[model samples]
Target: MNVTICVGSSCHLKGSPKVIKRLEYLIAQHHLEDQIELSGSFCMDQCSLGSSGVCVQVDHVVHSVTPSTVDSFFQEYILGGLAS
Candidate 1:
């Protein structure tokens, strides 16, 4: 899966760095380094939409993600796919 996190100014202020860190740690913990490709996007337009969290794209599907929600996102989108 290709996961892209918005690092635009708005997202940065909203805690993108922390979200990225937690996501990295979780990906490593799940040994998904090979299965997942993580990257940063300059702007994804979610900021203009007034999203509460950082804008993240999983396989081109965008989502509002935060550090606190990283675990569930990973579990459902990443790990859950592995189980199936």
Candidate 2:
């Protein structure tokens, strides 16, 4: 899985750092370090529409992600797929 978190000025202000930290922890917890490719980008062009001012791309799908939503996002997109 490829996960890209926007680190633009807007996203940074909205707490992208926290989101990144939590995701790192979650990926480690699940032992997906080899399967998941995590990265950061300057802008995704979705920041203006994001309620949290942070945009994340999981594979090719863009989502408005915040630190609080990272857990559910991981569950649904990461772990959920593994279960299936």
Candidate 3:
């Protein structure tokens, strides 16, 4: 799976770093290092939507995310059939 998290100014201010850290830890904890490709990007065009400015794209679907939401996001999208 390809996971890209926005690192634009808006996202950065919203805690993209924290979100990235949490995701890294989770991916390692679940031994998904090989199955997941995580990276950072700039401006996903969702920053103006409010809520957490962090926008995560898993494959092609995008979702507004935050550090606190990483675990649930992983369980539902990364580890579950939703991703497949």
Put down candidate 2 lDDT per residue, 8-33, tens digits, no spaces: 89999998999899999999998999
Candidate 2's error at 45, in angstroms?
A: 1.0
Give the poorly placed runs of model 1, Cα more than 4 Å off. 82-84
Clash pairs, candidate 1, are none
Q: What are the per-model C-alpha RMSD values against the true structure?
A: 1.5, 1.4, 1.7
Cα lDDT of model 3 by residue, 34-82, tens digit: 9889999989888766365588888998888877787888788888843
Between prediction 2 and prediction 3, which has the larger lDDT? Answer: 2
All candidates' TM-scores? 0.89, 0.90, 0.89
Which residue ranges in model 2 land beyond 4 Å of their true spot? Answer: 82-84
- Where does candidate 3 clash, by residue pair? none
Candidate 2 — worst ten consecutive residues by lDDT sum?
45-54
